[model samples]
Target: MRYSREHKLETHARIVKKASVRLREKGAHGIGVADLMKDAGLTHGGFYAHFDSREALVIEAFAHAMDRSTERWRKLAEQTPPQKRLASIVNSYLTPVHRDDPGHGCAVPTLGAEIARESPKTRKAFAAKLEQMIDMLAEQIPDVPRKAARKQAMAILSTMMGALVMARIAGSSDFSDDILGAGREAVLGRATSPKAGKPRARKAAPSAPH
Candidate 1:
């Protein structure tokens, strides 16, 4: 008895989707290949048929999780106009709900640091997906240049990731709230302000006085 290629591909997709959720809930390093397989309702040995190794699965799963997260953000953007989208994105990213629920949250805030230590292939996948995600976010800001939009998106991402890391490390709700709120204010205020497009004034050149 053999499975058709379409069936195999469907099974692989199911496994990857389940693995992505589990990977976010529990850090990627925390979940064993066997456990992930069992959680996916598939036999452990079947894992090799879909992916070359656990590393391969990890990268795929990360990509899957990222895509899910990005789609959610895009949908939110669709409901709002461009002028308000970035602020909405920042507020959503910094909430306690996003902090407490890793399974459905962005991969960058959950497992990005761990992915950095992974193989170049895994890192490259993250980088490529990250750029695509940022581009989609940038599209929500009207009249902004590509480079400026990219920079704003990167800053928003960094602030969200950094705030979550600090909140997790501090282990205090008060501190966590402070970190999240401050980060949210800083990012949203700066990114949405008119100053976002204005160039900084340079100091006057020193005079060659006689």
Candidate 2:
């Protein structure tokens, strides 16, 4: 049956998004075209109708995942004070919760090593999205020179990604949360954890008349 262009476009997007999440959880080469198609509720033969090649799907999906990650961080940063923007991003990203959920968290820590080994076209796509991320991060650091801000953004991302990788590797181990905490502290100069935070103090009582 012939599907309308709109239907086709929606299906294509669905496939790409499914591929993005699965690939983040399972790595680029971890899943196959047939399985990815299956997860998208399409047959293996139907895959060719949407994408030219599995690598094409990989490129699109990786870009999709990176775009979502960037959008999330941008929204989060915008909601905070200008000076606290970077720290807000760091605290949110370098958390044990993010560390524990590869499928839903940032793509870099899960897919970076695999991306390095992908074809030039795939690598190019990855680099393009990465530039967007760096730009977003740089925008959050208003106090530095643009060049230095870019560099700092790179440093913070590298530290966060590395920490995420290490934390996942040590998942469920004693130091998994520590790894996340250290990463947050390294990026923000202090750490905050949803787990370790104290309850808000009650309002102070009015002073008695002297």
Candidate 3:
């Protein structure tokens, strides 16, 4: 039976969302298209109806995952105070709750390695979302130049992602907690203002060197 356009779109969305979760839980290549479709309550044969190929589904799924992550950070940042926004974000991300829920957490640490080896199209799509995430993070930083803030955000995110991977590898041991703690401290340090709650004012240039 043919489905209506709206229904088809809804079903396609369901598949992408399901795939997003599964792809994070499992590695990028760990689960096949059939399993993803099955999880989405559809048949493997119907996968092509929504996507041109497995890679297509993966690209969309990865983008969906990153979008969800960005939305989450946006909400958190909204609730947090201006000066503390970046710290709040870092703390939220480095906790056990976030670490234990890769399916719902940030996609960078979970899917970064696999995406590294994916087709250029997939990597390009991932990079596009990654750029948005970096920008979102940069917005949380205060008392810094935009270029410097973005650079700091990128460094902070990279450190956190690597620490998260290590923490996951270490499991629930002290090592895991240590990794998380270190990650939080390292990133939060960058996010923290040197003087705390005070902006560094740029000095005025002398008038035409008089």
Candidate 4:
């Protein structure tokens, strides 16, 4: 039986949501299309009805996961004081709970390396979402200029993602916890410092006349 337009849209969203989780849990290209469809409660043959290709599904899923992450950060920023917003976000992001649960956490640390090998369209989609995340981060920076805030956001994201990846790779829980703690401190310290996001001023040129 054919489904109505709304039903089809809902089904499509379900597939993307399931794909988003599984992609983080088992890297892009780790799980087969059939498995993703099965987890979505649909048959393999029906996959094309919702997405043109696996790459398309991946791009959509990546965007969905990033959107969830951004929304969560936005809420955290709204509830937090302007001065402490970055610290709050960093603490929330680097916790052991988030570290242990890759399936439901942010996609960047989990899927970023794998995405580098993907098609241009997929990488472009990821890049766009990443910029949105940076913008959200920039908003939390206290006194920095816009350009400096964006730069700081990039550095903060890089540090957080790297630390999480290392934490996951470590053999022991203590090491993982250490990594998370260190990362939280480092990011929060930079974020809260008065000079953290300030751009360096250029030196004045020597006077032309004696």
lDDT of each: 0.75, 0.81, 0.80, 0.82
Q: Which stretches of candidate 3 lie over 4 Å from their true place?
A: 190-210
Please give each candidate's TM-score: 0.85, 0.91, 0.88, 0.89
On residues 24-108, what C-alpha lDDT tens digit does candidate 2 reach at each position?
9899988999999999999999999989998999999988988998998888876788998887787778665676678877888
User: Which stretches of candidate 4 lie above 4 Å from their native place?
Assistant: 190-210
All models, RMSD in angstroms: 11.7, 7.4, 10.6, 11.7
lDDT of 1 by residue, 1-210 (tens): 799999999999989999998998899799999999998898998889999999999989999988877887788778777788776766667665666667877888778889889889999999998988888777777788989988887877777778877765665466676676667668766422111112324221111100
lDDT of 4 by residue, 86-134 (tens): 8778877876567777899999999999989988988999999999999
Shift of residue 63 alpha carbon in model 2, Å: 0.2
Query: Please, what are the lDDT tens digits per residue for candidate 3 over residues 1-210?
Result: 888999999999999999999999998989999999999999999999999999999999999988987888888878778997777777667765666778887888999988999999999999999999999999999999999999999998898788889988998666676677778778766322111112324221111100
Clashing pairs in 3: none
Model 1 scores worst on lDDT over the 10 consecutive residues at 201-210
Error of 2 at 95 (Å): 1.1
Candidate 1 error regions (>4 Å): 190-210
lDDT score of model 2?
0.81
Error of 1 at 148 (Å): 1.3
- Best model per lDDT: 4
In candidate 2 the C-alpha lDDT for residue 208 amounts to 12
RMSD of 4: 11.7
The better candidate by lDDT, 3 or 4, is: 4
